[model samples]
Target: MIRKIRQYIEAQNLCLPETKIIVGLSGGADSVVLLYALQRLGYSCVAAHCDFHLRGEESFRDEQSACTFAASLQIPFLKTDFDTLGAAHQRAISIEMAARDLRYEWFEHIRQEQQADVIAVAHHRDDSIETMLLNLIRGTGIKGLGGIKPKNGRIIRPLLGVSKQEIMHFAQENALPFVTDSSNLQEDFTRNKIRLSLIPLLQSINPSIEESLVQTMAYLNEAGKIYDRHIQEAIPAVFDEESGRIHIPLLKTFPSPESILFELLKNYGFESERIGDIAHAIDSQSGKEFYSEHYRLVKDRDAFLLSVRTINHEPTTYLLSPTTREIQQPLKLRMRLEEITSDFQIKKENAVAYLDADILQFPFIVRKWKQGDKFVPFGMTHFKKLSDYFNDHKFSKPEKEDAWLLCSGNGDILWVIGHRTDNRYRITERTRRVCCLMMECG
Candidate 1:
């Protein structure tokens, strides 16, 4: 078992020899075998365990067993408890997902604190097979068929090359003490159902089904390498990083455009179904928008415009007193009171707005533009609707949404900031003082 794991680690370049490793020990057979094997191979190992507090006393029992096992080996042990159910309710996620997230997050924290080279988890071959089957049941792409990888960033699974049966046999042969969580015996979770029932039913049909599935996953992993390379090479043809746009015509020219789109967008939190809808919008009308949790993708006339969603929870309104010099949030701006002198020439730059200091009041308001907003152009005598002004300027939807309005305390628009200043607030010949507002460049 040690030799198999060491070879897998070397092949995957997971870590260096004698480097400190943070091992996730759940007191289960798989994790116990992994910790024992890693210690036997002469690597510096620190045992880390997470008590999710889900299974009543069983949870504490598992933690105690893990702590004792690490003590028996004279290894350092670290443990943390989590309110798994509370976190799930708070995060609006499943209990299993909440526990998984909490466990990995705390493990990474411990790894960095201990200065470990990498984090090792015992996800054996059977776990990867279960993951693949789960992804298939949920409807997945080609990448999902490749199963769990041996290494992902700082997380490494050294036991992925060994099966669950091999781990159990090795644990028994070495007389290693481990505790079993009763949750595993109950078919309450989808994964447990798969292991306890579905796989057995398939095994009854074909006794060697697990081996065949593992072989199939091996083939898929190899094919996935080529597929990934193709995707990376083809991305340059359709995506423009500088403008954050994907050329629709070029995208449609590719075969299986939906698959390409899905691969490109999956990391942006977009699901497969939404990605399929986006692909279908290629021939549809422009001005359509799709939203993920943190990203917004707009179907423009010629391309897809992708941008981050403006955080709604952040303050949209900001106040600036006469003595204020600058503000960083709700957009950056530098403000100062300037005097009108003989040689003082008003700056004509669009980004610099010069307001009459004598006419202006303290505590100016800066906020996002809204519908039915009206402002007078610097040269025009009449008020113009902001929507019309946007249309005349050919402002895109994103640009209009991002526009900010600087106003007086009386709720009158002072400047359509960074674009045009209201005529009512412009400095005139009688103005003894001036307020210069400059929008800082990013």
Candidate 2:
């Protein structure tokens, strides 16, 4: 088994000869065997154990046994205890998931502190089979079916090419001391239930079930590589990294729009079930939006805009006093009271607003545009709904979302910042004082 692990490691180029490795030693049969095998293979090994405190004294016993074994092998040992149940409750996750998260996170921390080149975990062929089955039951995509990778970032699984039976046999033959977790026999957990009942029944039908599944996983992994390459090539044309947005034209450029969208959005915390709805919404309306845990996807006129969901800023109204020359927050605007002269030239830029100061009330308010908001656009006689104005001007959903309105103290719209000004505040020839407002993005 050690020779086989050595060959697998060499073939995969998982680590260099002099590379320091940290093994996640749970003192279980699989992990114990992994630690001893890596040591026998002449690699610098450090043992790191996590006591999840799930099985009372059994958990402490496991930790003690792991430390003892590491000492016997004269290896550097590190261990940490976790309140598994409390963590599960806090994270709103299952006990199994919480424990897994805690252990892997600690292992990575140990790896970096120890200057270890790689962290080794004892995940064998059987574990990969179980993972594939679990993913299938949970409605996973192609990547899930690809099964566990031997090397993922700084973690390496040398035992992945071997079976659980082989690992046990090697442990027994080598007289390796290991502690068993009694919780493994319980049917309360989904993984344990699958291992205890489902796998045994499958093994009854075909004794080589694990081997067969391993081969299937290998094929899927290769296929996933090809799929990944295609996604990489399609990304350049379909995604704008600078703006963190995905171009919906990818639907027309790709054969499978839903599949492509799922791949693109999956990393952004979007679920598979929501991808279909988002794809359908892309063709329906420009203002349609969808949200995931961390991101929001807006269906614009020509593309889908993806952005991180930030804390929603409270609707704040900033008062621009007559003495105030500039206000920065919400939007940057420079205001000046200029005496109207024959040489006074109105700027062509929409960002610059020349309003009649005599008609304006003091302490103007700058706020976000709200529903039912109306404005008498410059050169227009009748008031138009702000929503209608946005549509008429061909503002995208994002553009409308970022729109702000400047109004007088009497609640009359003065300027739709960066767009249009109300004709009610427009400078007339008879106006003596002009409030020139120039907006600049910070």
Candidate 3:
């Protein structure tokens, strides 16, 4: 088993000979065997254990066994306790999921603190088979059917090529100290039910079901690589990263457009069903919008705009004095007082504003545009409603909401920052000094 583990590690290029590893030692049969095998294979190892405190004394017993085993091997040990049930309740997740999340999260923390090359967990062939079945039952995609990977970022599974039966046999042969969590016998959790009931039922029909599933997962893993490569090549054709827009027409040109969109939008929090719905309605759902937890997707006439959901907090008014050279809260702007010269040329860019300094009052007010707001646009004689200006310029809802205004102390609109400047404050021949404000784009 140790030789198999060494072969798997080398084949996967998991780590170097001198690579320091943080082993997730639960003192279970699988993890105990993993720690012993990795040590025997000549890798530097440190044992880290988590006491989730869900199984009461069983949790403490596991921790004690882990600490004792690490000590017997003269390996450094680290342990932490968690309120697993409380965490599950707080997160609104199952206890099994909460425990897994907390365990891996703490394992990464230990790895970073110890400066370990990788964090090793004892996920053997049986565990991968179980994971594949679980994901299939939960409606997973192609990636889920591939089962657990040998390496995931800094986390490595050295026992992925080893079987549970092999691990037990090796532990018994080596006289290893390990503890069994009695909870495994309970059919309470979904994973426990799968292991205890579903797998056994399958094995009863086909004696080599595990081997067949493992082989199927191996084939799926290779196929997933090809699928991912096609996805990588197709992404740039449909999605524009700069504008965060997925062009509907371009997306429709691809085969299996819904599946393509699913892969594209999944990272942005869009679910498979929602992505499929969007894809089906892409042509007819103009002006419709969909929202995920942290992102918003708007279907325009030609494309889908993906943007982060921002909080609609009350607009803050920042007062800028003459001495205030710059203000960064609402947006970044560099302010400078410049004297008009004979050869001075005004920049025609919309991002810059050249205001008559003497006409403007001190302590300028910077605030977002509000209802009934009007401004005399540059070179215009009459005041125009901000709404009319926005309509004429074809501003989107987000653009209008994000618009900022620069007002004089007496509340006279001077400039619509980054859009237009009031004609009343425009630089002219009579203007001796000018207030130059330039919006800095990130």
| Best of the candidates, lDDT | 1
Taking all chains together, each candidate's TM-score versus the true structure is 0.78, 0.92, 0.80
Model 2 lDDT, full chain set: 0.88
Q: Decide which is better by lDDT, 1 or 2.
A: 1
lDDT of 1 by residue, 375-441 (tens): 8988999999999999899776787888999888888889888899999888887899999998986
Cand. 1 TM to true fold: 0.78
Model 2 misplaced stretches (Cα beyond 4 Å)? 241-245, 310-316, 340-346
Candidate 1 residues lying further than 4 Å off, grouped into runs, are 71-76, 89-92, 112-115, 233-244, 253-256, 311-348, 353-389, 404-417, 420-438
Error of 3 at 214 (Å): 1.8
Model 3: runs farther than 4 Å from truth? Answer: 16-20, 42-44, 67-78, 83-98, 105-116, 169-177, 204-207, 236-243, 314-328, 332-344, 354-367, 370-394, 406-414, 422-437
User: Which scores higher on TM-score, 1 or 3?
Assistant: 3
Candidate 3, after superposition: displacement of residue 41 in Å? 3.6
lDDT of 2 by residue, 87-168 (tens): 9999999888899999899988888899998999999888888899989887778899988888999989999888888999
Which scores better on lDDT, 1 or 3?
Answer: 1
How accurate locally is residue 178 in candidate 3, as Cα lDDT from 0 to 100?
A: 99
